[model samples]
Target: MGQLERATEATLARGARLVHAHPRTLASVVALSLACFGAAAYGIAQTAPDASDLPRRLVTEIVAHEDLPSQLEALAGHELQLYRSEQTRAGDGAESLLARMGLVDAEAAAFVRRDPLARKLIEGRAGKLVRAAATPAGQLEELTARYAPANADLAGTHFDRLSITRGADGRFTARIATVPLATSVRLGSGTIRSSLFAASDESGIPDAVAVQMAEAFSVDIDFHRELRRGDTFSVVYETLTADGEPITWNHAAGRMLAAEFVNKGEAYSAVWFKDESGRGGFYGLDGKSKRRAFLASPMEFSRVTSGFAMRMHPILNQWRAHKGVDYGAPSGTPVRAVAQGIVKFAGRQNGYGNVVEVEHGNGKSTLYAHLSRIDVRQGQRIDQGVRVGAVGATGWATGPHLHFEFKVHGEQVNPLAIAKSSEAIELSPAERQRFAGVAQQIRGQLDAALTVGATVAE
Candidate 1:
């Protein structure tokens, strides 16, 4: 029994010594075993009968190649004459339009002046592209022009195209038709570097679209004072094209479907919503109207020289409460109305210069002073953002600056405070539900745009 125990102990010690002597070899063996087991298990799990029943045996056959003649027909060659296009320049009259089109026909000129339809073709239409098709001898065959009238809704109607064609009998026939456009939604994002217009140009956004975006949020934010470097914006707007080509660069000038602007770390969003009555307006995600009772500032952009406070009057040379805030701007800068009101007084007032006072209901009145020109007349009803006058230093002693004041119940108040404190309109219950769906769709588009913008930035 003792000899057997000793022999077993010796055997265990010899095995341990062998493992310690060749640890690398032992590890390799274990690794190799694991690899083999894993391979076998994978092979067993992946094994399957051939689902496609096809022959495994190989067969060979020889085939002959046959040659055939070409079946393509030769195209007849002809000279390609492209229609020439030219933009009507400033001071362009009927003679200039005809001259640019390479047409010298006296009958065509007379037709333009005599016929009503022909007169509509060139009446007051400037800076628009006009295309003409002419013969090799400079004889005008046809003239075409497509344009949208001033303030026309692009979504509801396409551009009007007027085609004046000369028949083989030498008689001119004029016809007006709608040039259809293919509508599409485009997403764009830009970061403000120097100015909004400059940044928009760099981001490939049209100037008209940028202007609309500013107007969309003009009620809450003052673009001139609030815009900062690195402020970013993303918009999902509509674009129009004709024949798969862009018809106009300002295709998105009509309406903005969705817009987002992050200014000073605050994000403002607006989505367009149209009710059953076909009335549309920009609204927030929570279904609140973006339009307020008044805009943030009378001017689109400016710098405030003096805030509402008690200070020494430059003209009076005495200390007095400056009831109105002063905004320094260039002469002839357009001044907009704060809200819908009636022009209570328009003309020169004591120490106010050429001032315009708009009286809103509920004993609220707004005063715009120091104007070189007044566009609105007394007792005239005016809407918000309407240009009332121009900036000038008229009454009060100062440079070209606008003196603006707000009053409640015949007492003067700070215009900036009232503008910021006014409540925005809200949507109805039924409209809220509809706006929710619209907002969801806009959110999806905005998300996709953010992703694309991030990728582009990277």
Candidate 2:
């Protein structure tokens, strides 16, 4: 007998009174629902048309058949040809290469070994793309090998096609032809899990493309020192193909068209562009050139072994101020000029070993020391990125490494600092409009590249 019980009873009584007051209206709602249900039930109860009463139609056509014996004879007369493709191995010879492709004709193998043009397949560099056609009976019908052009200068634009075919007289003939290479645009993206090279490899990016990415962002990020685990990159690049097959030669990798690299939380972008005068370079979307007065590193990619600081010298075994930066790399790795300049000195120094010194104007100079071989000579004018020498340990020191130093007015300073503080090339006012259009197109491609990379990573 609480107040709550009284309120509940009053609410129920009010609802009952309302229902009684609207009885006719409620009856109409119930009757309408019943009519709808009756209609649905009647539709469900209706039977389908009787199968015997349904209309039916029949149609027939004649098909000619060949006699079994004639079919068998025709199949027997047709020689089954099998096609197989493989990459040439380092030590592959005529017999071994053909055997791997399921070809067993001794005559074809003999011609490959004796013919001057045919022997080129097994010679020179390995990894050439080879395709062969053979009969079911193991007779070689034809073979074609595509590799880098014979002329080194033409490698980027052409490829050498070697064909060995069986003639009607049962003799094998070999011919070599230089064919122009085809170009295709390709997109790639990767996240830096461990290193740039590792991420690029996981994304199926070519090594050359990865190197180009590093060079593209070299001004903003020191790949060797500033690379982080979560850094990511997207790229649009050109690929050279021989007869629709991507070339495997190192020299055949085409130039990078555009790239976007996100290091840490900041993103940097670059697109390759050529001006009216045909002078080409990488520029940002804002129309600023990425090329500076000098490159951060003399080598494309290498770790800094020693910095410009006071430390125990590896050779002297005593604490001394190291004026130059030491980069650890494999022996014979190409060393490039840091900036465009004339070679002031290119010869052996007492402690520096085989060194190349280039004097940039305005009292600025750079030195590359401990080279295994010098490619440039004194008084030779070389541009930035021109190969000057190869890494070596020729001085009074340890293993193979390149010693790099930057000087301003005969005083040694940190090369990295000088490279970073150098002036950047800017685009002309006339070129900005044309560059904006190219930048817009490249931005979309880079976004697509990022999507592709994320899918691959997953």
The number of the candidate with the highest lDDT is 2
CA lDDT of each candidate? 0.80, 0.90
RMSD of each: 10.4, 9.9
Alpha carbon deviation, residue 404, candidate 1 (Å): 1.6
Model 1, 124-232: lDDT tens per residue? Answer: 6465557888776766788887666444665344666778889989999998776666777788888999888888788777676787788778766776567899998
Worst 10 residues of 2 by lDDT: 246-255
Number of the top-ranking candidate, with TM-score as the measure:
2
Query: In model 1, what lDDT does residue 97 have?
Result: 79
In model 1, the Cα lDDT at residue 167 comes to 94
Query: Runs in model 2 with CA error above 4 Å?
Result: 1-81, 250-252
lDDT of 2 by residue, 1-458 (tens): 99999999999999999899999998999999999999999888776676799998999999999999999999989977789999999999989998898888889888888999999999999999999888778888889999988898887788899999988898899899999999999999988999999998888888888887788788799887789998889999998888889898855486789999999889999999998899998999999988898998999888888999998988779999999899999999999999999999999999899999999999999999989999998999999999999999998759999999999999999888888889989878889999999999999999999998888768
